[model samples]
Target: MYTGMRISEICNLKMVDIDLENRRISVVGKGNIYRRIPLREDVVYMMKEYVEQEREKSKFADSEYLIVTQRSAKMDRTAMLTWFWRLSAELGFRIYPHKFRHTFCTRLIQLGVPILTVSKLVGHSSPQMTARYYVKIGMNEKLHAIHLL
Candidate 1:
């Protein structure tokens, strides 16, 4: 989920699916495709902490997923949305889970990541979808034509 995986794919993730040594998590992305997402250090740390706590509680003894329910079963999109909505309401923020994904792409574009790369990372099937929000910010040399005119 942190890597912008579709809710369905995230729900299907298993602990063994992640290559923790390589810092990569494999995802079943859009169009039934598969891709590997690099794990950020923060994500790695969070996972480590979660695993440690889970082992201590034995609540996840039989589960091999990063997230588990009270019954130690896989988490579904509905559960995710319910939790997200409740938290957002409490925080008084008009936030949706998907908005964070959009923000992730927007920030990458602002940082000048190539459109193709961002598209791949976000699991967009086409660069066109990725370009929808890459509105140019600040100066563009093309705009210098105005001064010349």
Candidate 2:
């Protein structure tokens, strides 16, 4: 969720795609386009740990993929969805991977991030596309707006 990458992009992530020192990742988005996304410090830290600890312990230690399984196989979208489903079942809530993209956009909008900036961050073709599809003004924001007067 830190990076608003598509599931396909996340699934295809390679270790080289991450620039931990730079605190960003390069992802291949829809239409095979590449984009760089900034990462939070915690996310970068966790990625480092995962690479140094978990990945090294796996049979796929030599694998180029960022995330791998015990069998040393690169994960696909189906595997990601299955994991999300299992986690949602355990947590007693509806959760899905794609929901994260929406949440990411929503959170950015809630923070008063401009649509143009958000669009660039999320790899939208234009601010109009981002505003038309992703931005959701809820009851809370509506109420808050009225009270601002």
Candidate 3:
């Protein structure tokens, strides 16, 4: 999911919408902006495995949904969060999923990814939103000024 897509966009994805050969998934993001997100090799592999498993047990073989419930219903954000929160509690992590999003941005900045790209990846409206979270952590002016003399 990290290749740059909003949760709603991902939830709307179908198997037919994915370009396996190109390793990209088309997403309809905020403002109805359509874009392709590159998939990591691991993500591609996992998706392939999931699809194959879904195919065998699926009563509706014609269903093109990328993800499905046991009854073959499309997944929604609320159910997704219910699962996430349940798993988080089981793992003893009391954090919200949004915290992971913030951590993702922070780690990307620390890894030297450009702020503009990170902003786009997170589906932020602008770089200013991204900066609001990371800029405080990047402050070193006070320490650097001591050496300027």
Clashes of 1: 0
Candidate 2 lDDT over residue span 1-149, tens digit each: 88888888888999899899999999877766668999999999989998999889988889989989875469888888989999999999989988999889988987899988888887888799889988777899899999999
Question: What would the TM-score be for candidate 1 when compared with the true structure?
Answer: 0.82
**Cα distance off (Å), candidate 3, residue 59:** 3.3
Best-fitting candidate, scored by lDDT: 2
lDDT of 1 by residue, 1-149 (tens): 45866667777888888877788898877687777889888888787787778644766656877678775567878888888899989999877677777777878877888889888887888888889765455566567766898
* Candidate numbers sorted by TM-score from highest down: 2, 1, 3
Worst 10 residues of 1 by lDDT: 133-142
Better of 1 and 2 by lDDT: 2
Listing every candidate in turn, what is its Cα RMSD in Å to the true structure after a full C-alpha superposition?
3.0, 2.2, 2.8
Full-model lDDT for every candidate = 0.76, 0.87, 0.73
Clashes of 2: 0
Task: Report the C-alpha displacement of residue 35, candidate 1, in angstroms.
Answer: 0.8
Check candidate 1 and list the clashing pairs.
none
Clashes of each: 0, 0, 0
